[model samples]
Target: MALLEIENLAVEFQTSTGPFRAVDGVSLKVDAGEVLAIVGESGSGKSVSMLAAMGLLPWTAKVTADKMVFDGRNLLGMSASERRKIIGKDMSMIFQEPIASLNPCFTVGFQIEEVLRIHLGLDKAARRKRAIELFEAVGIPNPAERLGHYPHQMSGGQCQRVMIAIAIACNPKLLIADEPTTALDVTIQKQILDLLMRLQTEHRMGLIMITHNMGVVAETADRVIVQYKGRKMEEADVLSLFESPKSDYTRALLAALPENATGDRLPTIGEIFKGAAQ
Candidate 1:
């Protein structure tokens, strides 16, 4: 069975100008042990859609869907209390900015231990032990010693590793990573992505990878959904999508890949489309 399912989902925000639909008529599914990649430029609603699904969107955002189910339950109709219980236990998200997401006032150990306390109901000692294990699992060096360090003390990569530790603390069935490698150097980005993939396969979790980086998608995803302007441009298996993209937008993105850039000036999407039009 699909771990997550959404149909005709729409999300609108009450902006100053008017109601702006950030996500429009989107539909997709994620199955157990599968890596589903949502690729789009910023403000394309890839992150917003998943946030809405997790009931994390603010009150200003109006979310609706014809159908939304997770683990065979109706997420569209579930109560907030029920949703809260499932969010940390059954599903968890690793947000975009790692350091920004952590509470500056607390130690990394405390922040991650909170997840174990709340969801797993682990005792203080147990929480500490589990947090150390999670830290090590995420490749954080000196896992036991570093847990006491505050967000400011850790590097971007370390902060992200802490975030991953918290996200997987409960061994959730679904893991959503929203630009998990955003500000890291190229070397760290690969390490972070590799760690996430390892955890996902090890736990047999359904993974949703949201990013604008086609390179990450190409290396990790089993299936890919290309989005533009809050709508799906195309959906296909990773190999097929890269080998022969159907939509012009998808084709343009593939064309503008760093590997495909040969000349001094990288080709812009508009330029590619304009040439096609000509």
Candidate 2:
């Protein structure tokens, strides 16, 4: 069975103008030890879809799905408490913004320990030990010392590592990384990706990587899903998607990659379509 599955998932937000549908009829599944990449431009609902599945949307957002299952449990049918029991323990997410996601007032150690305490029922001493081990596991230097530091004290890369440490603390079966390397330098981005892949391999966890960067998809994904305008445009194995994309939108995305440039200026999606039309 797939580690996670969602069918006909949709999310609509109640805006001042009207109800705006952000995700429409999106469906996806990821198996254990597989890396699935969801790629799209900004405002394509890539992050919204996953957030809906995680039940993280706000009250103004109306989320509905025909079916949403995780590890054989029906996520759509679970109560708040039941879902809470599963969300952090069985499934975890590394959010887009590391520094913003963390609490400014508390030490990083306290925040991660809170997760362990709530889900695993670990005592104080055990939580601290596990936190140190987790920090070490994610390649943070001076793990014990870093635990007491606030999010602001660490560099962006280190803060991101702390987020990874927290996400994997409970040994989740699935991990959703929503643009985890956003705003980081290229070097830091590569390091974070490598660390994530290493952890995913070690734990055999299903990984869903939400990203707009084609390079990230090539480096990490086993399969790819292309989304545009709140709908799925194409789905294929990573190799096939790159070599022979079926959808024009996917082709346009590939064409926009820097390595694919063939002229003085890279072609925009409109230019690509216009040239094809001519």
In terms of TM-score, how similar is model 2 to the real structure? Answer: 0.97
Number of residue pairs clashing in candidate 2, backbone atoms closer than 3 angstroms, sequence gap of 3 or more or interchain:
0
What stretches of model 1 exceed 4 Å from their correct place?
Answer: 262-264, 274-278
Give TM-scores for every candidate, taking all chains together and pairing residue i with residue i.
Answer: 0.97, 0.97
Model 1 RMSD to the real structure? 1.2
lDDT of 1 by residue, 209-229 (tens): 999999899899999998888
Best by lDDT: 2
The sequence of per-residue lDDT tens digits that candidate 2 reaches over residues 123-176 is 999999999999999899999999999999999999999999999999999999
**Error at 266, model 2, angstroms:** 1.1
RMSD to the true structure for each prediction, in A, is 1.2, 1.2
- Show where candidate 2 strays beyond 4 Å: 273-278
Clash statistics: count for each candidate: 0, 0
Q: Which residue pairs in model 1 clash with each other?
A: none
Query: Least lDDT summed over 10 consecutive residues: which range in candidate 2?
Result: 269-278
